[model samples]
Target chain A: MKKPDTAKQMTIARLLLQGNEACVKGALAAGCRFYAGYPITPASEIMEAMARDLPRAGGSFIQMEDEIASLGAVLGASLTGAKSMTATSGPGFSLMQEHIGYACMAEIPCVIVDVMRGGPSTGLPTQGAQGDVMQARWGTHGDHPIIVLAPSSVYDFYELTIQAFNLSERYRTPVIMLADEAVAHVRESIVLPEAGKVAIEDRAGPTVPPEWYIPYADPGSGIPPMPRFGDGYRYNVTGLTHDVRGYPTTRKDEVEPLISRLFSKISKDIDRLQWFDSYYTEDALVTVIAYGSVARAGLQAVKEARIKGMKAGLVKLKVLWPFMRQTIDAVMGNSSRILVPEMNMGQLSREVKRVNRGNCEVMTLNKYDGTLITPLEILRKLEEIYPC
Target chain B: MLETAHPIHKYLRSSKKFPHIWCAGCGSGIFMNALIRAIDRSGLAKDDIVLVSGIGCSSRLPIYVDFNTVHTTHGRALTFATGIKLANPALKVITIMGDGDAVSIGGNHFIHAARRNVEIASFIINNQIYGMTGGQCSPTTPHGVKTVSSPYGNAENNFDICALAEAAGASFVGRSTVYHTPLLDRLIDKALDKKGFSMVEVISQCVTHGSRWMGLNSPVDMMKWLKEHSLTVEKAKGLGETERKDKIIIGIMADLDRPTYNEEYDRFTR
Candidate 1:
């Protein structure tokens, strides 16, 4: 077993790792004991790494028949109180949305790693595209409070996967580590955290006895303490519209509260749940809203635009869903236009438009040829939006 | 009334959740009752048994019982059950599925799970048609059966589920109809006790839809049909080939001793 390097006394050295490899190392560090996956391009490396490493750390892995079964197993392991996860891209990710809804409605805390690939039907298996940005938020039908975290760099890939697990546990919701193919396959040297330096928070256990405990009871925090299966509670968990006691119900009064709670749980805590970084938008005339790999180019364009005396700034989204509206408000509030560059035809820009609410022009620099948006393209778009 | 209700109520959820959604003549309730009695008979700790079911009348068994249950998506109960068993080997995981769930949309998972021989019990409610979706022809719908999806006749041949499970390497396999309550309950008990990927294919009757279309509309008729059509394996062995062609051979089809996946996993990780 690898010793915890995050301990203050331990000296940690930098390791060169692909984003996929870093994700496995981070998940293991977060106490993930079960991994269920189905192989798909660009994301399959994560499965391979997890299969090799998770078993060594006393964890288990299963290559399920399909993505639906993969997430199903992940949720089952989670019900037994194991930190579990699965990795997929494109078609496989689409297969998982049904159970992702189950995880949300059942309030199962597990991580889903979507290593974004080009799609609309296996369009480009090896290519990176942020087409799933909107899908991550609204793909699973019905009103659901969802969390999607995007990582732009190798270090962010490592750190965000851990963050995904922590947020999922804390909120009792499935967290999406939305890394693009670029992030998953890109290799970079990063300073690995020493063991114990990274904080690990497991899901809270029920304090009350089985008799008094209601499985879905929310004492206004909108988060209920979960009892692991076989811990003597004998409570129930299902996909049905259930009551506080976890029994099926058809009452409108009961249905509204359960459905409302599902959305309100995260919407109420947007401050703690939302995370992003903004640059120079306070004084700029235009801000480019970007996330995932496109955000890397957005940051570069912002710097280059600034050197050439164009008041160009960037808001790189680290947390995509339950989107940081206030963050965009801070960045685009002072600007005349917000330039949204992405591999998809403006998926996230639509959300920016919804949240920005005509406060500024939400123009998009769209690319869908199975390639990353170059810094030059973003810079050119920024110049066109607000010529210096 | 309260005293008498307590015995059955102890195995079920609150009264408000009852008058269960099951139709009047369905045999799924019988299967559910047998499952509950078998658990009670085995004296297994209630908290240690997790019931995971897929969508359908059969999958709704977990909705009535008071165990730690999850009524999952259509056709994926075994996948979830596999996870629960692998996560905590001490817990007894059981998956409740319909014929459509186990043999059609979920066939890959059904076969893979049996092949792995994971220590989880699966109960397949074979009602010969898709009961949930308005009596459509299912993968296990009998040959030449007429229904909404197959109004003329079912072109597909039914899957002999016990043979499929045994072929897929399930360590224990059994088949019994709801009419044979004692034997069906015993089948469930032995399957649960086998310590591997054990399965009991219960020949449940869906009276409202498929069975009604097949002319077995009432509960009495469905039960009688099941009893008359199915022969005990002992009796089946004596019959001539032509005489046994239409009978459902019933009994523990396979029971063998082999190392279970749970113990093997522990050893490999250790």
Candidate 2:
């Protein structure tokens, strides 16, 4: 196949695209061929782009009836061996939890893009909030591990989507790209990578014969080779905790091994899974921890604080799950205090404190009014504590 | 000779699991038997077919079948079947669901799958009531019928599943009752041969739930009631609107050809 030139293509060059559009481009660039989604606010553009582009790109696009069916189709399409994805906001994401758990337990590879909006219920349909940070980690019933990537900028929206698909395919679990309204709607100049320039990861397929292939058989790497349906390999997959053959079983011996692998697969590979960008961390007195849209405000605050001659730094988390405790601890170990700002009521702050273990004083700046936390607001909180 | 000649009965036993999960005189078992007979006659390898079902008494049919089967959550059987079919378009995927399972909780999946024209045989056992959940009014329950949830009588008009399937773009749509065993069997045979979305809405009788709640006492009585009340689509066409009012139409409602979702998807991917 001739590699298409992407670097020289700058038709509009400055054509306005939302963060959601960047996500679509990223998914398409990452080899997403199947998109199943139900339209929801602040996230619908991702579906719209897929609908428009998938057909032309020789891919499939389905507008499912609701969020549950959307995720259901996505999981179904992934099993067919297509790189599948679905985008939704809060309520839709909530409905997708059960299937998300199924994806986790069954080890299905798929991408779920959640454009965070204000919620508990239909709290703010068109607004932005980061309240689902914890839910993304533990919303589904049962013990399972997941990878969540938070993208702060429109550029990260493109990059994180590719990472999300790669992580999902590599780990054989659902990976979430958590974006908020600010990030989702924000338009910025982003240089699109030529098609072959970016790395695309496909799920590992079964190398053994049908009889030798156990769908969930531990390859000792914690992830088994996933065989797509219609490959003449007969294997059963169930949502219930099951044995290696994918048959449902309640045996204690079988259950422990399966659950342990589910955790270890990601935990052991945490280095490749953790993604963060630290700014001016050397000799910093205070570290500000944040993710998604709030990280933008935190970065700006750090920049402003630096002008005032304060030794404040930013620890922006791109990979929010697997906690990245080692990196977080390493970054904050020298700092006397850390300021964790988020849209929710101190969810990630609690995580910071838990990981810090009283080594540093942790302070939280929470705003739940469906608006972006301003850089000035974070700077004021930092000044109140550090008093520079 | 004919009694001992059926190939399905040879592979299947008449023992305890023989009579199956359906109540004696329930049409579901008769339809199930027809499905087995069609499969046996199709000459497809048993290992090549996978039967999937959602939550319902009818959904339990796949569990009893010796072939590879999946008993999934209510209404999501088609989604799982789609997964299996897409992974291997060569695998003959069949999904069995009930009225509430296919149309109520799973209605969105049903219409979308049909619209996509996914290549799978979808067998919907429309027993009128939520049989497993103790006779709640279902999407197909007759208007003004009183059930546990509709003590004041169901005010909602039921979905015409055949119409819904046809409108949603299913390549094949057929309706039959347990009374017409031969026709149901023939339809199943055709559906198995058809390459796109083939839906067979078997107007089954939920004797335990519908009979007790609707004041129809026994399975035989319910079967008799279905025979008396149901009208063939052709027969209904000849009758006036008033005469055909509240009548159930049984026959192949619509049949057309459309590219199956998987086939189109495969062409794209390939």
lDDT of 2 at A125: 84
In the order shown, the candidates' DockQ scores are 0.77, 0.29
Q: Which residue pairs of candidate 2 clash? A: A229-B87, A229-B88, A230-B87, A230-B88
The CAPRI classification for model 1 reads as medium
lDDT tens per residue, model 1, B55-116: 88888888788788989988899999988988888898999999999989899999999988
Name model 2 segments beyond 4 Å from true. A1-18, A120-126, A192-199, A250-257, B1-33, B43-52, B61-72, B79-93, B112-120, B134-137, B141-160, B163-171, B205-211, B214-249, B257-270
Which window of 10 residues has the lowest lDDT sum in candidate 1 chain B? B1-10
Worst 10 residues of 1 chain A by lDDT: A3-12
Which CAPRI quality tier does the interface of model 2 achieve?
acceptable
Off by over 4 Å in 1: A1-10, B1-9, B14-16, B238-240
lDDT of 2 by residue, B17-36 (tens): 23355666677778778899
Residue-by-residue lDDT tens digits, candidate 2, A147-203: 999999998999999989998999999999889999999999877765687888888
